[model samples]
Target: MSRASLASLPATPPVLAEFDELLKMRELLLAEPDEATASAVMRRFWDICCGTTDPERVGVLEAAPQYAVLRAFFSVRWGIHLRRLETLASREILADASATDLSAASMLALENYRGIDGELDLLGESPAHNAVVLGCGPFPETLIGLQHSALVGESLTGVDRNHEAVALADAMTRRLCAPRPTVTITHADAEGVDFPAFDLVVVANGLTGKTRLLDRIHRTAPPGVRVLVRNPTLLARMLYDHVDPGPRSGWRVTERRATTALSETLLLERGEHA
Candidate 1:
């Protein structure tokens, strides 16, 4: 229920200044808050992202503000509005809507797709066709893109803990993926998902209880199955839980690729002899 977590990175004074400005805005909104007003605040932050082109700094500055603004708007409303936002955003992408008309949800679908698409090379030589996407939300955009891209196989599976999200994504999948019927959507918690012998598993960002999910994958997935964890970069990590990839976690980071200016994905495998 929190947004804009304090990331412990070395300070960039100007970006820090922007964060302060965001904090001030957050303060005012929290004092007198409503969905419409909070949405307006989100629009201001989105404008900041649109205007800033410097990848080096934009990673930290832009992501933080967007997270803060959206958190203000939809802190606990997890059903209709959130799903609507996701559904519309994804449908716009599928419909090829112009950038000017995209709402916050649509913009997010674009961003997440673009980022995941950029890292498609991470699956190199690893038969990662049968993919299971953890935390598949209302639209399952990542699964859609992966299905279209070369990263996944003929079959794709989406798993989510929320039944509403599962139902919503399933309905969208049936409608969105019209030409093909290769994607399967299931309702299950990340740890308890009865995974088949999949070749790859994609852990989407913002999944609740992420560390335990990783541990479950390590134990439950097939031997040599590759796991990809898409995570927000240092700047956006303030709002989400950070899952480390290294020796202690029984996973080794094989490839680290940037998903967006402010986010990254890592291709990993269980350590040898783990």
Candidate 2:
């Protein structure tokens, strides 16, 4: 049997008492030979951790050991690469925002670190860039970053499915990004939208559900257009699947980092041939 299977042979306690239940969950994942069964168990573990059955909450796995271990195992089985990119992104946002100076809830949201800032940075760097932002939420920080970049001069157009989010993004631009480069936010589904010629595009969250968006981008993007994706796990998955080389076709990936309190931001861009 594989090492993972051996580890799953029986529930064994690690030194951390708090992680005992997590170990049991790992054992279950290991023992299951069926891919579907293992996936279901992993889903259940995340649902319990996130306090909801919604798959979106699976993002909570960043803090849950059971989910983390299962995620590692799944990555190996599926030939995926795993990186703590989101963890890093959250740290940078908090650091930039001085989240430690804020309340607990605010810290939590910032710490969630979904790669919004890094995406913004890419969008900001590409003037006259046509971009699509998936899972663009109500947070104004992303727009703020874009505005700051534009102040020095950068033109960008953005699309999102959430009308409210689009409106908020537009409002943020007017308030924070005014008197400079142009920015437009519109409501459109990521998978179905008509993309224009752009130097760079970004997909923030929606890793699992948004892979299809890549096809849409490819169809509309000009040759040699740059694409930046934030999800580390998805990046790993793409690499493992041998989808295509990136960072060379003008595609690149960068990771954001922060302190233990997740109150600082750092970016590391990885280059690979596409």
The clash count of every prediction, one per candidate, is 3, 8
lDDT of 1 by residue, 1-274 (tens): 3433433434446655666556556566657678787667655654554445565775555455345544444333323344566766655544653432223346656666667656677876445658888889877777767766655556788998778678767765665554442888988878787555687888887675678888878777777788888775544454345688668888889888877765678888877534
TM-score of candidate 1 relative to the true fold: 0.72
lDDT (10s digit) by residue, model 2, range 71-176? 4555453321112222333334444544432132243345443444544454344463444445454444444455455422455566666565566556545544
Model 2: lDDT to the true structure: 0.46
Full-model lDDT for every candidate:
0.66, 0.46
Query: In model 2, which range of ten residues has the least summed lDDT?
Result: 78-87
Give candidate 1 misplaced runs (Cα > 4 Å).
Answer: 1-20, 43-84, 90-105, 178-181, 194-196, 272-274
